[model samples]
Target chain A: MSNPFQIPEQEQHELDQLGAELRDAMPEVSLSEDFHEHLAAKIENSWSIRSAFQNNRMIRMAAGLLVMTLAAAPVAAWVGIWPQQKKNPPAIGFEIPEEVNVDESGGALGDSEDNQVTGPNDEFEAVEWSPQRRVALERYNRLVTAVASYELHGQDMELARFEGFSDQSAWASASEESLWLEFARRCAQADLSPLSAELVARCTLMLAAPLDRNASKQQRAAYAAWAWLLEGEQAKAADLQMNWPSAPFLTQN
Target chain B: MSPSSDDLLTRFAAGDPAAFDELVASLGPRLKGYFLRQGAQSSTAEDLVQNVFVRLLQNASRYQASGRLDAFCLRIARNLWIDHRRRGGRVFSSEEAFDRADPRPGPVQEADSGDRAVHLRSALDHLDADTRELLELAVLQQLPYREVSVILEIPVGTVKSRVYYSLRKLREQLHNLGPQEDLS
Candidate 1:
């Protein structure tokens, strides 16, 4: 390959073997182990960057959607149709089957001072400090109120029965002194029956498991390599591919 | 190049993260090594490679796949390298970045891939940046003259002549490094 500058730059020899020798001598290089971690972060950012380039297209498409939405707004408003944003919490309500008898016997043996749910420092306030636990307690309290109102008797009450609700194992595995378990015990010790309180606790404690709707047990990890990033809203948010699947439901918000 | 490597662009364009992953895993070393071959430090090479992927993703929809995945990546990598130089590549401090960027013993020295190629690496390091880049494009990547022309943004004739000169320079440098068994 060196015939060009040979004459112009004094005496020189052609050594085409250098390419093959370099190939033979240099081993194929390996990437750093954190290459994928860096790549994933870049890909996520690229999704946002790709969108910026098509902001014109997005604006046009959004305008078209807005016109159609405006046309249907009056009829939709009269009929009481409301589109829920993905970030909004689900609008779920269930009728409670039985009434809370509320053990008002002035201080039954089961209603010991230590048995009630309370903040870490305040034993009197029946409120939980953790937002997640508060959600559980709120749901539990709302169900008790619904049962007492006796107003709604026979709605689809699926939650009342908690049929097909997984996470029984999670609830069962909790230590006896778990705060939720103690709260459930308090309910059971109240004039409320064992079965109903157990059902309520089982239905609610599932939310605290730190599981994503899309996650599964690893079973085993490939210490050598990482799996691909899941597709959908993540892939689509990039605005590059249209065939990615829609994200499955239940983002906790 | 196997069809599997060729399809990194195709699969990535279709939004396959695994394909994107495979593309990075396959092409990342080439890019980082290219920067290193051109005398970039470990952190700079890593940052350049990262920019290449981000650029590829940004242009995935518009980039016409020409059945050359390495060329596609190298094109971005070369451009980023230019930009990186213009910005006056930041001085890297802290050997910590060095230890992290390379798991092997000191840069590419202890790459378990075997064979230090110490003389050749040292010889390549001695070459000027432009000479090393020309060698990287023509000799190392072995890209066709036309692809090399486009990536370097030079005429094919210029590529041919410069690569010849670069080869002569590298051959001379290796000669000066003296009778290393590997090269001899």
Candidate 2:
């Protein structure tokens, strides 16, 4: 008995014939004789460069040392270990007044005369960086690095790096409007002078206020135009501007 | 060839130059064929294959032997093509202009049975980009349906159905063109 699922012999023959024809028709490509030599040379060159980079450990060590020295300078000055020079005055330590009442916001709430006290107090009330704030700052740095990496590498690498860090989930989970606004505020506060103009523009555009609810069609179009401009798609941005003349972002110089 | 692809890849990752050479020998033709069939120029296909190898060398540590190397390499090729299209400002539309822009000579036009070959080429090209890709992966690459699904990022069922329909479409197009040219 023949199997019900089997293709008819004629149909199978035709398909087999088609496959044969296709195989014949398909072009056979081969690398040139020198291709392997060229690839091997490239690999060698890459290896040499990589080895050179690895061997230059002294430069990295020097950089680390410089950072450490810079970091310790303030501590040395604070501890009065550095000798006073004509240009650089000796650091003076401050003593917190014992009678001063400090508010939760770190504001002095008592008279200066009543608060006058000698020597540094271990219990001095000051606005210390909270753990949450520290984490936020770290996450912000990672976000900036991630964005830069995305620009330099590509989306897949960026996504992989992002997946390695859990803090990114918080940003992703947040509302887009709030996230953009927060990013804008942070970008404004950041020293973005070191970043390229394109990155600065990306940060700026990311921070751009989302279209207001009940906004006109022109406003929405303008926002999109600004977004495209930020993303370096000048042609699309120009088209949007042309179509939506009333867009406020387009009007801005 | 004694060791599997996974073994070769693992050795390649360990910086075994011989293993790398072995991989290059094994994968080079397949990669070149895939790119050429996908309408890349010979030079561009060579460049793409080189890039894939370079990427593999760089990201060797990230490879998991459990995952098929062919699928991984094909995915990279696909990504490179996508990036190439994006950089050229070629937006995806019904008719992919980039595929048509490929300057390389397509399927052996000078074959003995020229009309049939030409008709088959036209039919193959006429299929939608996805269908064409499916055929390339399933038929031309001769990848198993499971591996094809992995490369295409679709379910095995979808692969089977899509491949069936794509083949049916190709057959129908051939039938419409004229009687099948006898293979014998």
DockQ of each: 0.22, 0.12
Residue B105's C-alpha lDDT in candidate 1? 60
Q: Quote the positional error of residue A192 for candidate 2 in Å.
A: 44
RMSD of each: 29.1, 30.3
TM-score of chain B of each: 0.79, 0.78
| Candidate 2: C-alpha lDDT | 0.55
Kindly report which residue stretches of model 1 are placed more than 4 angstroms away from their true locations once superposed: A1-14, A47-51, A60-253, B1-6, B91-116, B181-184
**Model 2 Cα lDDT, one tens digit per residue, B17-97:** 798888888888778777766667666667778878876775666677764687778878888877776777333321132
Q: Which pairs in model 2 have colliding backbones?
A: none
User: Highest DockQ among the candidates is held by which one?
Assistant: 1
Once fitted onto the true fold, the runs of candidate 2 whose alpha carbons sit more than 4 angstroms away are A1-17, A41-253, B1-3, B89-119, B182-184
Using all chains and alpha carbons, the TM-scores for the candidates as numbered come to 0.47, 0.47
Clashing pairs in 1: none
Highest-scoring model, lDDT: 2
lDDT per model vs. reference = 0.53, 0.55
Candidate 1, residue B183: lDDT? 35
Residue B2 miss distance in model 1 (angstroms): 3.6
